[model samples]
Target: MKTLQSTTFKAIADDTRLRVVNLFVTSREPLCVCEIVDALRLPQYQVSKHLTILKNAGLIIVEKDGTWGYHYLNENNPLNKMLFTFLKKYLVGEVFDDDIKRLEMRLLLREEGRCVVGFVDEKDLLIKIKEKKQELLVKE
Candidate 1:
């Protein structure tokens, strides 16, 4: 018999899930799976697997828009909100810091506050950032 306590803890027991939670903690914007994969430097399937576990545990929620599904931490429950605050305070390290940096870079691809491009690999991300900068300059 898995209670909510056990299920919630179990969902975050894995290192990958912890990382995913950390991303959600840091991000104010909901992210799509591909953005998470690119930020975590992991395969989409691997990230998606952890995402499913988090979803099932009620730690996060997904809002689907057409083919893209944006995910964010679920804080509707008081316990989950408290857990989110705790994780935001405690989950730290070079690895997590790197994920945030990569995620910030990935977020540059968002258009009008939504993810427009999918899976911008690290190399292409740099080029895309440069292009975006040029576009901004042109608009200015």
Candidate 2:
């Protein structure tokens, strides 16, 4: 399990990966791959690659309902024990800002047992909003 712990830590070592983890932790909802990519303002391939690493390290799990794959925190994952302990001891003053919270709530509202393209569902309107966030982040 040391290998797993090491791998998870390495995967989360990058700012992007750390942000992704924080997003997942604060959202408290199963998130689609596209949602993660959009929220993080990352290229689709980059997001997918990092997600694969996290999954391999046993830090996250993916659930596929049709073509949409939703990723969520793995409570039973051994890495989570370490992550939670670390957060409890060190991340006390952290908060999910308004933008992140808004993104999370929008994603939550889009869930309907399966993933659908944003244009296909009225509830998926949040996709446009997420895109705006990407634009803003890129400018920074």
Candidate 3:
């Protein structure tokens, strides 16, 4: 599923996407689309659109419980696995500031829910990056 892998990378390439992923990664609870949008201070439609992209890339999953759509990281996805490995090796030491981490934590807690962390696999990371680049091209 080269296409899947590519889409996954694309989803992660944007700063917004990365932040969304980070929120999912560190969140202690699941979050709904509204919660995510409010947490990120993004428009509802934009957040939904991004979430849709992430879901398509297999980086995230939506669980429907009644009228709520909870988004969580999909650790079983191959692309996410790779992202985790890469982050552990190269990104962990970057030292995110307390404010940023707190912001992330606060965002995660917005809807009073729980989320599961998912790892990005190797192939998916590449695919995601490629897709992100393509998106940039389209914007240009």
Candidate 4:
């Protein structure tokens, strides 16, 4: 168990991994890889790399829905739950504030509360999101 704890600690040691965990803590729903990419403004490859580490460390679990894979904190794991609760309080301010804000925006683009906007490029997703926001504004 000590080895597992060490691996978990090592997984979250990186700034990006910590930010990802913090994002999960703040989110009301599980987030897909594309949504994570959009929120972080990081390449999918980088996000995937961090996700793999977190998964290997037993910090996260992934679920497949159709073509998209959604990631969530490993709630079933006692250690993960404990760590996530700690993260929820510990990581407040600039450490992950911007990423959380961006995640909120990314979630707004969801269609029927599901992550359907899979973007190969961040710019394309931004354009679609802008159009969707304008449509909502016009409707109001």
* Model 1, backbone clash pairs (residues 3+ apart or across chains), number: 0
**Worst lDDT 10-window in candidate 3:** 111-120
Please report, as a residue range, the 10-residue window in candidate 4 with the lowest summed lDDT.
116-125
- Runs of candidate 2 with Cα error greater than 4 angstroms are 88-99, 108-115, 118-140
Q: Clash totals for all models, in order?
A: 0, 0, 27, 0
lDDT of 1: 0.91
Local distance difference test scores for all models: 0.91, 0.66, 0.60, 0.84
- Per-residue lDDT of 26 in model 2: 68
Error of 4 at 112 (Å): 1.8
Clashes of 2: 0
Task: State candidate 4's TM-score.
Answer: 0.85
75, model 2: CA deviation in Å?
Answer: 1.5
Q: What is the TM-score of each candidate against the true structure?
A: 0.95, 0.68, 0.59, 0.85
Q: Which consecutive 10 residues in model 2 have the weakest lDDT in total?
A: 113-122
Task: Give per-residue CA lDDT, model 3, range 33-136, as digits (tens).
Answer: 65565456566788788888888877777899766688877788676777755643443322323323544544432222343322223335356446656776
RMSD after CA superposition, every candidate: 1.0, 8.7, 15.9, 2.5
TM-score ranking from best candidate downward: 1, 4, 2, 3
Give a tens-digit lDDT track for model 1, residues 52-112: 9899899999999988989999989899888889989899899899999999999988889
**Candidate 1 — which residues are off by over 4 angstroms?**
none
lDDT winner among the candidates?
Answer: 1
Candidate 3 accuracy as lDDT: 0.60
